[model samples]
Target chain A: MMRVEEKLFQNRYRVDGARAHIEIVDGDVCAVHCQDKPCTFCCPAGCYAMDNGGRVTVITDGCLECGTCRVICGEHRNVRWEYPRGGYGILFKFG
Target chain B: MSEHFDAIVVGAGPAGNSAAYTLAKAGLKVLQIERGEYSGSKNVQGAILYSDALEKIMPDFRDDAPLERHVVEQRMWILDDESYIGGTYRSANFSKPPYNRYTIIRSQFDRWFSKKVRDAGALVVCETTVLDLHMDGRRVVGVRTDRDNGSVYADVVILADGVNSLLARKAGFHGELKPKDVALAVKEIHFLPEQTIEERFSVKGTEGVVIEMAGRITQGMVGTGFLYTNKESVTIGIGCLLSDFKKSGIAPYALLEQMKAHPAIRPLLDGGEMKEYTAHLIPEGGYNAIPAIYGDGWLMVGDAGMFVNAVHREGSNLAMTTGRIAAETIIDLKARGKPMTARHLAAYRKALDGTFVMKDMKKYRDVPAVMDKNRQFFTDYPHLVSQAARTILTVDGVDKKTKERAIRKEFARTRSTLGLFADAFKLWRAFE
Candidate 1:
């Protein structure tokens, strides 16, 4: 199995360390209402992961910004998604 | 201070670039905003450049467009777990000068196209995000950007934003896209030596091959896998509906690794170095899902408006065409000195309807629905067809008639005779 992290390592991204373009609007919705958190796995970049507390956590640094999490979080509408302030996200070397 | 222009084209991908290029060439003051570091930094595609579409925009594009290869052979394969039954159609005509299609690396290609837009007199702005539509009642008067005092007024606004068109959604142009409406695709570019690529795919210079497959690799999901030969890299990807991925709990990356591991596909990228992996969504909802294209002081183009013709694996062409046509419509309005009203902009729809874009879309409008419901087409047919091909091709002592019977019996047993006939009929209706 190819490590997705290694694959993402080959891509280029300029992280805005201060801002998160996307976040779960409510942690409770994810912790309680959301079961089978698809975002934890659906993200091609593996940006979303279950943390030690079993809550879905997202790190936007590795995001390719495909908007998979925003769309897939249809039930709760809990994912607040936005584009990183213009030059601050995934810069595909070979898009 | 607020900036004003005759037109504002948002998102500088193929559609936005095409629209801005055409509008600025006609001497309209156009402001094209892109969210990426540059125009193409956010775009991705399976990426076959249709010459006819670009030819309509810039007939001399082949001279310098960062093209990788001109496709000379097209292969369609149906894969089982280990085997694929396939066919190739290669022609000398495709290999000749003035080629039909070329595989493009979108980042380089879009950068080139965006430069052309800038050179054409449009004030192209990069690293700017359009935060919201500045509306006058129901009319989209301009856009509010994230920049300080970034409200840009325009006579007209063209939304050429790519697939995740949140601006349009936020404006209530269309409802949220259902998981069924889009397919999430992930791709990788595996770099190999130019000579190695030529030797492996059996082509030299600019000639390349494209292989498209549908089968068990999707794990009975409605999806396909593809490998395209670039100059020194191969673009390989697989995609299925978001719903399927959600339902099956199959990670798209895992699916790609499995596809790369397929026996028939492995050797082509056997020793290549994979450098970039990207993911994007393709609007597969066909014609039916196309939202309202024109509105008062506003118009939508490309993936934002769901203009992709998915059945034929044609999207970039439709994007460029729609972008060009939208620009042409606005230009006509300007010549006659008309307001950007819905009635006046409706001409864009009529013009698009007159082209092959709408005709082809109408032709296969049922495909997404048909293919979505019929999981067996992606699963059973690939296996049975590959089994049949292998059954007859093997050099064992089994007689030809006996082998044929064995294949027939296996098919009938797995999917009953009635099921097989229904599938044929469904295929005819869906594709025809």
Candidate 2:
């Protein structure tokens, strides 16, 4: 099976290197409220993760802009989600 | 400083393009803005284009539209772990000219559609996100974009921005989308030689086949998987409710990988090079989940209004139809010298109610809820059905009557007779 990252690598993106479109509004919310951190698993782009230090991190570079993390994080409402500014995110070549 | 137009359209997907095209063609001053680099760059679909909708907008679309294939066959599969038992509907009539549906790649199709909108005199600006609606009290006066001096005024704003319509929510048009309201779909386009695809799918020329699968493929989730044959590529994907994925803790890509490895699906994609991987949200909430579609000086179309008929797996058609209807409502109101108020724009909703967009949505309103509660249809039932097929087809040397009894027993084991009846009744009520 291809890793989620391998699959995401097939997509095109004009990454907004200096900024992230999706932000964890409260990282502590994931730690205290969500034991599983659903976004860490449910995100199609594999953008959410737990670091070695047990901190939640969201790398928005490969976000397919599917809005999964935002909607899945409904209980905590932790994701400050927005579409990437203009043409700065994943660009689907064959969408 | 601000620029104003007769109408401003947000998001250049099917819905936005349809609204922009219709309004511009009717001689309205229209400005359509897209956050993608181009019209379809951010868009994706299983992509069965309903010609009737486009025909209503541009009757000559067949002339140069970048259509991949006309669907002449449709296969519905009920899959188990390693086998599928389903039916195929193929017709010579569908193979004839003036097709009813055609497979499309959104990137190519949307670019062509935006071109038509531009040719109709609509100003289509890409790479510009509408940050928010410029509201004066409850009335939307214009939109604030990411660009400098990006506040653009309009008599009316149409929000065609796909499912994640943050602008609509920011403008307080709707609350945050419930997980049950939208589906997270992941798709990959596999490239194959044209002749190879033709021989494999039993299609020639522009003919195509669409395979819709349900059952274990989604890991018992209330979702489906599909494969559509394009000219030289096969579009394969799977999606489940966001709530389902959350509950199952199944990564979307993993579900897709399992589906591709299914015996029934593996051969179809053999030797195909996957070139694109995409994931997007599809509003599957049906009728009950539809939000405020129209308000003072603004209207919502497409997935923003939750127009997807998940029952039929038909979204682009509804999106285009709603967009066109919304545009027509605006055009009619403009012609009558009426303001684009909530009262006047009620015509858009009323117009949609008269079309299949609302009718189909209303008809299948109960389906999603029913399916959500009924797990057997996605899990045990598929297994039972496939087992029955295998039992009946395999030469076990058992008598026909005994085999029939065994099949009944298998079904009864999965769902009791009363449970079976109730499930059937539930499905009947949902579909009815």
Superpose all Cα atoms of candidate 1 onto the true structure and report the RMSD in Å to 1 decimal.
1.0
Per-residue accuracy of model 2 over B355-393 as CA lDDT, tens digit each: 999999999989988999999999999999999989999
Q: List the residue pairs that clash in candidate 1.
A: none
What DockQ do you compute for every candidate structure? Answer: 0.83, 0.88
Error of 1 at B50 (Å): 0.6
Give the per-prediction TM-score of chain B.
Answer: 0.99, 0.99
Candidate 1: Cα lDDT at A24: 87
Sliding window of 10 residues with minimal summed lDDT for model 2 chain B: B1-10
CAPRI rating of model 1: high
The TM-score between candidate 2 and the true structure equals 0.99
lDDT of 1 at B139: 92
Candidate 1, residues A6-63: lDDT per residue as tens digits?
8888999899888899988988888888888999878888888887776888888889
Model 2 Cα displacement at B261 (Å)?
0.7
